[model samples]
Target: MTQLDTAPARLSPAEPSVAEPPAASAVARLTTASPLGRIVVEGDGSAITRLEIERAGALSTDGLPDAPDDLTRRAVDQLGEYFSGSRHDIDVPVRLTGTPFQRAIWEGLRAIPFGATRSYGELGRDTGRATAGRAVGGAVGANPVPLIVPCHRVLASDQRITGYSAGDGVPTKVWLLDHEGIAHR
Candidate 1:
């Protein structure tokens, strides 16, 4: 990921800048330091939309717009607290975009509690879809908001740490669980 200390591209006064507040409805990006690495958070002014833990030096912004927003600032602060082990939960507003099934799975994930975990099948069963384990796993994998949504708390059927889409993958998942005081094999 690019260095957060570096200033982002700024518009000159002579140029006609978009009148919209930075990150209000349009995309805004911010990077905050973390125990694992630098994290890039993308959002619309209303809610946090995306989060990426930098693994390689590269940061991804495939189709995202650039701007500043208060939501991003809040998210960064919350994340900082989380990494420092002072915050157990994220209270920031988040915009989750996904299919109905995915959204349901995401909500289920949110309820898993701090320092606890549930298997995909267990999550599906708890959500009243006992036979949709694979589907539930798919939804968890497609989660748009990772840390805030708490997808890392979801484990494999055997309670093993499985795939993690952020940072260094499964290792990052283990680290997160460990930070929450949850033991993981």
Candidate 2:
């Protein structure tokens, strides 16, 4: 029999604490209930940095002011309209944080017109990498902002559903696509 060794790791004194992010990266967050569940929006006064659907937990916004800025308010309102099927587009500015390829993929995703979906191969071709469908899929999967970037509009080559990173996964994706009147294979 082999014996396993376990020991606690020690942190260097110069290292920053991992419990909280740096002051410059500190974000104010707000939570709103949607048809899908709670949506957490994080940003400062300028742009929305992150938007995530919470399936298991909620971010507390107890003492925080309700949408302290116009951008946040617009985001919440647009999301509301989107869920209600009254709005088909979102106009709020998003502060995209990712690599150049990821940003390009996100731009391509945004270009997928409402109620329409494109295959991963088609999206790759549109991004000027016709032979890089797998690479395109990787970037698509890395999308941090889902609904805003519209990554769900990208599908498999057979026009079938694929992976989704938010709100109940593929089922939520189906609901969103259905809400937009998109028919998939």
Candidate 3:
């Protein structure tokens, strides 16, 4: 998959340890979601800015003046195109500012492939950190971008699917897994 004209330089985190992101300016923002909640994706001049899932109508652009305005609409539009199978990859720029380990996990998640999946353990191996299955699970759960990162493609070792903080519940996760033909119960 190719990144778009606006692809960020480092979708991956910068260090091997967890650290806070330095304050930066954003260039755009927008949101999209299932019936359960709303997810707002923002971007800086060159990468994604925010990927927070919020309660329905939770966005109160009341006073947060720096909130992005450009990329959010792009994220929503592209996401809609994705669900419809008209687009195969997320081409918009994304920053995914987080810990280095989280960035590693996200990178692995990025390779989960369309209509495919991996167990936590499987992802651990693919990430070249076999001992980090639980850690990978933690990162997967913490994923701000789901369908984009395709976190629903990760499953448990028991061959059962679980844990999704976004959307209404596990049903969306299950439906997504099923849609991918992951063979789960």
What TM-score fits each model?
0.81, 0.78, 0.71
CA shift at 92, candidate 3, in angstroms? Answer: 1.7
Candidate 1 regions with alpha-carbon error over 4 angstroms: 1-25, 62-66
Instruction: Go through the candidates in order and give the clash count of each.
Output: 1, 0, 9
lDDT of 3 at 74: 65
Name the best candidate (by TM-score): 1
Q: Which parts of model 3 are misplaced by more than 4 Å?
A: 1-27, 33-37, 53-70, 179-182
Using lDDT, rank the candidates from best to worst.
Answer: 1, 2, 3
Candidate with the greatest lDDT versus the true structure: 1
lDDT of 2 by residue, 1-185 (tens): 11111111111112111222224555656678898888877765555767888655543444566544566667788889989889777766566656656666676777777898888888777768899977888888777667877888888887799787777788888888888888886
The TM-score of candidate 1 is: 0.81
Candidate 3 TM-score, C-alpha based = 0.71
Taken over the whole model, the C-alpha lDDT of each candidate is: 0.72, 0.69, 0.63
Poorest stretch of ten by lDDT in candidate 2: 3-12
What is the Cα-based lDDT of residue 127 in candidate 2?
A: 64
TM-score ranking from best candidate downward: 1, 2, 3
